[model samples]
Target chain A: MATTVESPGIRREWQRFTPRQRLIRYAFYLVAVAALIQSINSVDIIPEFLEDAPAQIVDLFARMWPVDWAYYPKTVHAALIETLHIATLGTVLALIMAVPVALMVATNITRWPALRLLGKFILVSSRSVNSLVWALLFVAVFGPGGLAGTLAIAFRSVGFVGKLLAEALEEAHKGPVEALTATGAPWLSLMLKAYWPQVQPSFWSIALFRWDINIRESAVLGLVGAGGIGMALDDALNLLYWDQVALTLLTIFSVVIAAEIIVTYIRSKII
Target chain B: MSTAASQPVAATRQNPFPVNWGARLGWVALVAYSFYAASLFELTWERFVVGLDNGAKFIGRMLPPLLGKWDLLSKGLLESLEISIIATVIGVAVAMPIGLLAARNLMPAWVTWPTRGLIAMCRSFHPVIVAILFVKAVGFGALAGIMALIVASIGFIAKLFAEAIEEISLKQVEAVRATGAGFGNVLIMAVQPQVLARFIGFSTYQLDSNLRNSTMVGIVGGGGIGSTLFTAFQRFDYDFVLTILICIISMIMIGEIVSGWVRKAFQ
Candidate 1:
């Protein structure tokens, strides 16, 4: 005769049906409703705000029309170049700085535990703040320009690339690395012969992806006085030159599309 | 595998990295150019030393973040929370269809190309830049900020979603299709299960990011605590700035904890 015993899955189901699960579920539902209620109150959409809002909307659109198309050629070239410069330099430098740091950070790659902890700390601190915050800090310290913008992008890229590369490194197959080591290859040779090949495709794609993000970010660094297309756009807005604003938007939109095409083509080649 | 002494460096470099003088020179030039670029940027110790005092002063001002205007800050914070939630919910909801259409493996080139292009254009902008555009288009307010972030949310989540769809186990999808199931049915039965966790994960991440961004967008007059923070900065209310920073940091950390809890519950 078998003793009365519940299977693990049945035991789990029984636990879910217990009073504790029911209480937790109910509590969760209550909190969600409360949050939704809070949102409704905060927006203050009780008809008064909506009434005046429509007129403002109409006025805004009227002002937006008849955009100054002529402003495009003058503004696009210089600002676009600066933005590209910042992004390209940032990505290249980041790739350079990231490799050794990633190797050091990865638990499997870096045998020494202490060094790994230090690398992780470095990555966390660098990544903790957003790039805009970094731009703000650098702007205050170094006076605002493309240099500050580049630094902000580069520092953030380091954190991003290092963390991602380390994870990829950790997930790489160990057999090849061990084989190279067993054959008395030097550490550098082991990396070049074994590890890099496996991770290169992913690394290239991530780098290109970051480059696209950095370009967009670089454009906006000017808001903090860090310099780029953003500065010109900021000037246009402040002056209430709606036409110029429209022109700027069109330029940025077109350039961004072009960039996306380039990145897609490059990614296809690499992948 | 020869002895280290017997093996020629030429053999190792031959296939992948040609040992031509041109390649070696290219490597040398790259290293030299990098160092040259660094120096041109004026990243000097002297400048850093001079800035320390100013930095200290700035930090000092940010102290005891004055919560004197508690009502204003609390109200703004609430609005920000709403904007983030609404944007995440709507954006993620819309991304489902668009992402489905854009995945190359799932859709034909005609459908994928245009959808992909739209996502790319959306992705190509920072929320702040997008906010500025929306402000110009729709006028400055919470609405502009909301619209901007919604576009941002779509740009990111949909692309990741499309990639996720592309990476799904086609075997399962094919099996469902083999059962004479329509596209929608195959997606529901096979694709959704594989990608549900990632979609949830992306949405949570987007929400967290949106919360942080919601604050910044207000600096450009997009509405939320950022507007208040900008005012404080402009008024030279350094202490208030400090207070706002503390509040923002706490808010984000709380968001992280809450999102983590949500994920845990769902899983």
Candidate 2:
């Protein structure tokens, strides 16, 4: 089973590296270890921060005696609806924005290499940032509300969907596209007739997948004042209302699970 | 005039392909909607101009970053790094086994379904939300942060790694199993070799992600640099805030490099 394949020169050179090179690497590791040890020996200022925690924890949990069964009903109604709406809107918006750009970013689709590079650059920079960072930035601009949450979630979704779809497009079966092009079809026609159909399933599944993530993300955007159940959760925590916190956590967990199941069902049906 | 009239007939005869009217119309609609949406978002010239000035002022205030508070800075950095590393290790270790067990192509329905559900549950919340829950559950500080990130890590890495596993070549696996090898033996010899390089890639990527996330988990009082950075912002200590931001970016970039190196070495 040991089949002999020709070793490319670059790989051969890599395999022939000397021991001196290895020793230098070990020296670098030693320095890193020393610096790490110095950092660890630094005093824990964390104790000062935790000094007030005992009182806060006690006070926070004190009011949790009888569960707020009435408040639970309210949470189930309004807050649940808002979280779903935000996630749905964000998914719709991101899909709309991602499709065309994903086509442009796909290396095989875009005839002009420069355009593909620029599109990929835009996608990379956009996606490198996490959704929470985007939420914080939008909160500053849009002022704490659902709009900010929507924009933040949608912005990140664009990046996620775009990158994934672009990759799908890249990995598509080339035979159909080549055949279409050989028949003197226009570039757009080649893509529409060949590339789109092959990659569409993956794109659909990824979008459905994003929906599951977005629901959870939308729940927390409220913590940063972007508006949702998170705002309620934040308030409950600050005031040390464990019963309310418990209620919010329960709602989020169930909604997220339900959303996940629905998404799983949809992706299965679609793909 | 007669030649010009004849030219129209020649052009029509030469160019026989009919334009796709529906697609053209769709493109037009997309452009119009994008413009309308931009307007609705107030992404106007005036806003852009004012925003530039405001950003300049913010940058100006942050120009001279205060490194004088080395003690606090160093402590926070170390804590954040520890939180990230610990989370990455625990998260990846937990995720790898579960991810393998959850791969639809390899595992039975009963095992795959539950594992997939567990991953989805873990992944549902953003790290910050998870951190909030953990803080409430375990009490505040580094412990909460670690737990939150561990959950987040499991959710993300497991789902993706499982997908990677599921997408791998069944032919190669079948070839190994054809030699009358046991399931464990086949997985070790056949499955692991096919997926190991990619799994390493995923693990390193997760570590890099955990580093970035670790910085923010503290914003919810989970622990690390986020709480420190948040406090500095609230106090309008712009210089200190800038310093922290710079340090975070640098640390993340370094983490990215380290992750890359790890992947290269393992591969």
Candidate 3:
């Protein structure tokens, strides 16, 4: 029944479907494509309206090439270092804050409905707001620098690390925890002896992963004056220094790629 | 010799997370760097006190968020919606084919390598950076934001799609081929069914992401609520900034809820 080859001479495989099924499929695709086209048209990005777009883009790139390689020693190097510092410090701060929050949010650990709800709320609200907005807020308050950037990254990461680690804590095997409780281990001791071991891999993975992301984030936080390589890039663009912009971008690209490679290597070795 | 061998086993039982030299040294260096950077940034208690005073004033002004700028707010919101929807739709459509082409299980190295490289380039920069590039390319407005997000969407969804396709069981594909089915028949009968659910899940998630990203792109003159929000901040219009923040947060939370429902319905 599965192999329904009709003729030996034919190379084509035809599906025998009812007319209604074919009609429905066609109508479904037609509707989907039509809606998509409508939205595209609504955005009004048609090339016809911007006849010189290609030329402008070509000119922009032509201007950007032959990057100001000399810009590195003056500013790019210091900016790159600050960006890495922001990511590293932020990740550590987030991890310190997230541990207790993760425990409170995990259903198996917290047990109290109200506490869990509060923890979940913190996680959701933190994750919901983009880091740029957080950076903006901190910039307004702190008047812009690497401190604001670090705090923004930390706040943004708390939710991510907490949420994932909470899931990890909840999924841990119950047998060890129960055994520790039966033996009258203190709450701290029980967690240390039982939960910590099981959730260690997940906790570290989330921490490292967030650090990698923070690297990318802190790179651009300077656009809002949070202080990083992004500030340099933003300034260069503002001044219409396309060559400097090109150099800044290239530096950012290499830094991000290097971070990726480092994280991958560490993860492989550890995980 | 036997006692020495047993000594290491006893030590293993004492720690839940054993500290290797690499991790131990990593920790020491991280702590050292933290203090170094803190000093470099000149973090002082006196400075913090001044910052706190400013923060209090900012918060005081932010209360009772003003909603008087309905004209600008609604216009920006509508444009952001259009940008996200159009970007998501177009990005997902383009991604589907590219994703399939990039599937290592289905494609030759020559095809997968270049397609994967393109996706990587798309993802390397944050959306705001890409938006800046596109704004410079296409000129400022929703059009540039939409274009940047399409590239962002393609980068994200295509990679996940390719991974999903790679993970599917190939037995069904083999069986279809054994029946002398054409390549299209095999794909339709075997490959499509396996990956369709996951594809939908990725698409919904991408839309949710695009919506949040659309707001921020406007800050770089890429057209969205972000531009208004940026202006409000620059002018120190704390109440308006508060209102914009509330609107953005609510939209994101609603997106989260909607995507959750989408996943449930599809599952």
Candidate 4:
């Protein structure tokens, strides 16, 4: 505790945190540390591998030093293009699918509580499972192609886009909606005229953001034969073609950077 | 009625809905590209119908999901939980210093630049890709999954931490410094108080994300329920796959609820 003297006879004391809060904080820290210790104990780490990790990393890097640039024109290029297409198409598809879901989820838009719960459940299911897992499911049904990759990306993004879009719709200005209602506007017209404009900026922003994520995701979908650069990377990895692996990794990196820049630029311009 | 009134009405009747050529062109380009991409992928109506039919059968097979492989499923699930916990702990510990160094407000430009670049590189790849690399380096196990998730946690939480630090009120920092306090003391007294809540929030969020990712790293043999799920998929064990998926989703949902409670408590 720190104390300040107001007078010689009367001193005031100050404390940073209340005793209860301090206790809570300490308990949280204790739990975290205990969890960490328990997990570390349970996760088996072979000591020899741990000891040689540095050497192994160095050896791996050495093998990847001279990347096979020749692999690009042969296979990597087509895969990269397919990845971009999947991301773009998937984003568009997700936006289309998410609009109805968003409407259902937005409490102000959808009056039914059960529907809202159902919409939330749909969103959660979409989001909880990783896109890779969705890709696995779609790949099974669609038989391992760009279509499966696209569907996975679309399904995953439906949750993200729908959640944000619903929030935006919920926060729409009430005045316009009231005015629309006074004029006896139909539900469709009310949604279009009042809610659409209010959420347009955020909708585009969400779309672009999800599109950027989809690019990175689609790039890796090929690992499960869902079609994209990931398939090429998977092939190289399996063959232990370090140079090709390095090249594929570099391509994925550059593409990710490019997508980020493009999304940022578009978002600034649009929103 | 009057000629002057009629003239004013005619002048006021200008077009209210002006077309934006730029937006129209963008939409056009998007639609065109979508068409081209669909054709490229042979995504015709027939293909979609066929997919739907296949999906119907798939769902039918997945119904009443099998939970008979409790031993295997539990093992994988436990391994994923352990991986996420260890990764989050190590990653957050490692990220703190990196985040401090990367904060432009707190560090020199030289220190911030390379550190920011490293964060960007860490963020560039998906965690699975990183897991693949780690699997190659570490000879495939929970170690590789843990390392992959550690990288992801650092990339995510460190960037947000650095940003949060940058947004701190410098006035508090200056006042602390004016008291002749050392750098460490100033950070503890001024910076930590401002960012601790947010740091905790980011950490919990990262833990949730790491948990989600840990389940998937096993796809690349880094170790988790994902390898088992993948194997199940290959064997056409659709019911088992559904069981695994339900378990994963429920686990994540529970994690989300717990993290939400933690965040509220801290706040």
Candidate 5:
């Protein structure tokens, strides 16, 4: 047995981070600070406008007060309905399109690496381009309308739904799959009997979640002439109709909250 | 015994696959609604076929992407990058204290309630809408874009950060308190360590989103590549539009890589 050292002879202390970690952290901070300084320097901010911001905000809000409640029944109602239609229809379209992509992406379902990569490429391209960008493109090709908005929402949502659905598919339990395979079930039968039941709850949940997001997205697609409430908002803004703008904003806020509530309630029941 | 067993089997022999009535009804309603909505939009198959024809031509035109306007493209890209970085930095910095105050586990109900309300209001509006307001207020440019993105980052990061803080182990805080540490000390030592990695993760995610948004905010005159893109679209410069899209996608992919690296490094 070795003898223990005397306590007074040795120095003991505590260190929160190693030298390497501390260096790395300091370097990160340095880069961030540098980037911030450079960005601030490059951004063209007029001193006058910066100073006048508070006054400008106060003036804007002053114009927005006493919202145009009467404007709702006149124009906003139809636009609001259109927005909901676009959201729901687009979500359904996306669900239909995403299922195949999700199947291609899921490793457990599609054993080929090349197909999975292709699936990933589709998803990434769809997601990287913002919904508004997609709307802009669709509007150009389709001559602008709710059709364009619906297509944009569907295209944008495919990536999100496909990604999540693929993950859920991958996480399906192997026991049922093996059992079905041992019973000489075909691929389609295996998928339906083994994987579908396991992922059904998550599939519905993901659909609801995407629908909630689609509502907010479709509400703004009209700014690009794709159709919906944003068209009214765009019109009001151009006309300098602050009251109407305010009313539209309020309508959108309420719709978003309502969608959130509905989704949450449905998800709780289903999941 | 055999007769009794047979009777039990007969009684138990119900439908092997019972149908869900509610689900059936839901499907029917969904289908009916789809038809009605499609009719309202006039989204007929003929329209789709014509649009598909246009789309094919559009894709054909986009094949030879115009790379001639490097200067204009670079300028817009730089502006977008600047807006994203500035917005992300300011947003994350401002969100820190707000997130701390909004954490129900750390703060009183009164503090959390108001802070959470503010966060909700922030999150309710789309960034483009907020950008329009900022453009009007600030008279358009990168500043408006930056401000809009900052608001977005704050809304997203603060709520997530607050949730993270709330989920942290309270025992660490108790231990720090038992050591006669001040509130600030306790927060720095006990709270910061636990949440720092997650905070970094959230900030990086916000940065990625901010970058994506910055490119589009210019369409509303918020000063970025979006205005240029909108102009190109209006001018029917399909090739240039394709180039811009490609650039945006590549930049986003790069940002994803960088953010993933940062997350790994921090972890």
Candidate 6:
């Protein structure tokens, strides 16, 4: 259906492939696949319990079939709210903090190469570390709460927003900046009047996009006790409350979808 | 204020509705809710101070990260790298057909709907959540982590792949079709060349991301360095945890560099 062809002539033509062509195509795939299958069989990668995985998954789904709706109001609601809060607050804070870093990293803005390198290093390091790991570190530092989760989300977002923002900054129309600078505009005024204006639309979109991503990241931060629906999820999982777990997962899915819709709508409006 | 002398600059739009009211409302609501949320979370200055003290101590302990657990470290790293490579290969391979089917421009609604839905479901949950589910299903190990990452890899790349296919110039596909070529031949002759570079880029990026997530899945007992790091944390082996973190970060950075190189090389 992907192709426009409507007739069965394609299959008949497929069979007409020369033997040599077929052999060459099949041989490589066959060898690679055989090696993959053989390695799986040879390695201890598969555990004994894996044989029962299907059955266990079936059982697990059965247990989770009827989500505990009652759990939402009492347990999940607040944590879900906390997760949303973490995402929003984190994205906002990250955007604000990223402004300076973005400027420093943008070659057109920063004068010193060393400062640019420092900015790039900060972005790379932040981007490289997973939010969960940051949450783990923050949990140890802040004793596990929304603060830790919020901070984790913020720090993780810094690299992402900063990198994109810096690129946007560098790519901003130099025409305006050069025009303004020639008029003897100070650095701050020139940036505010020239650079900021150019990147505003993109910055808005990136901020929204980052918020959408942060929602996904913060949803899982609770697993490490950084506080959110995820911590509740961790608790439910630990207690084997499969019904509650199902409910939590559903909440997360809905929130993600909602955020996605929002981002789509905003980007459409802007662009 | 300074723009007053600029004689109504082009940046100053004449329309009263130039401001995006919806966005303004969004910002206001976000700020208001942040304050309310802060209160609910009890994010206090006093608590922050105490936390900072504890964090300082934690940092102090992490200064000289322990590198003594070479066996555990290398084993987990090797497993993670293996998991990443295998997952990327399998995920990209499987995603190709699904992506083709999911491209709304190429396929009928019925076909695209189910395929797109599948991609969405794959993407709905975070990798860690998926890892948790797989760990339970597969009874904990690198296999579970591998399976989770595969699903993640598929989810991450398939949507992009579908978009790439959708964006392909049908002019080329039509020209191939005009030659009375079979569908497969048309795909190879036209569609493949345009999309292959992008597919490679997405695949490499997925691999880089998978490497990071692979180290993380073990936190929930799915298997890898995360498990070791989690245990060190639980046992209050801050030094060891720090060491694992450094390793993980370095590995991720290396993957980032490699993937960047791959993308640049192709470009």
Error of 1 at B20 (Å): 6.5
lDDT of 6 by residue, A90-114 (tens): 8877987899999999988889999
Best by DockQ: 4
- TM per candidate comes to 0.80, 0.70, 0.89, 0.95, 0.95, 0.88
lDDT per residue for candidate 4 within A161-236, as digits (tens), equals 9999999999999998999999999998898778888999999999989988899899889999999999999999
Query: Which regions of candidate 3 fall more than 4 Å away from where they truly are?
Result: A1-38, A41-49, B1-26
Q: What DockQ was computed for model 4?
A: 0.75
TM-score of 3: 0.89
Cα lDDT tens digits, model 2, B66-137, are 888878887787788888767777788899999998999989999999998899778767788778766765
Ranked by DockQ, top first: 4, 5, 3, 6, 1, 2
Per-model B-chain TM-score? 0.85, 0.86, 0.90, 0.96, 0.95, 0.89
Candidate 4's docking class is medium
The residue-by-residue lDDT of candidate 3 on B89-175, one tens digit each, is: 889999999999899998899999999989887877889999998888888888889989999999999999999999989999999
C-alpha lDDT score of every prediction, in listed order: 0.79, 0.77, 0.87, 0.92, 0.92, 0.86
Candidate 2 local accuracy as lDDT? 0.77
For candidate 6, write residues B122-160 as lDDT tens digits.
Answer: 988899999999888988788888889989988889899
Q: What is the DockQ of each candidate?
A: 0.31, 0.16, 0.44, 0.75, 0.74, 0.39
Which 10 consecutive positions of candidate 5 chain A have the poorest summed lDDT?
Answer: A1-10
Badly placed stretches (over 4 Å) of model 1 are A1-34, A44-69, A96-100, A111-115, A175-201, B1-75, B103-113, B136-140, B165-194, B235-240, B264-267
By the DockQ metric, which is better: model 3 or model 5? 5
Return the lDDT, model 4, position B9.
71
In model 1 chain A, the worst 10-residue window by lDDT is A9-18
Give, for candidate 2 chain A, the lowest lDDT window spanning 10 residues: A9-18
Better of 1 and 4 by lDDT: 4
**Candidates' chain A TM-scores:** 0.85, 0.78, 0.86, 0.94, 0.94, 0.85
lDDT of 2 at B139: 69
Instruction: Give per-model CA RMSD.
Output: 5.5, 7.5, 5.5, 2.4, 3.2, 7.1
Candidate 6, after superposition: displacement of residue B11 in Å?
A: 20
Candidate 1 CA-lDDT value: 0.79
Q: Considering lDDT, which of the candidate structures 2 and 4 is the better prediction for this target?
A: 4
Instruction: Sort candidate 1 into its docking category.
Output: acceptable
Model 3: per-residue Cα lDDT over A28-115, one tens digit each: 5575578567666666465652676788799889989889999989998998899988898889888988899999999888899999
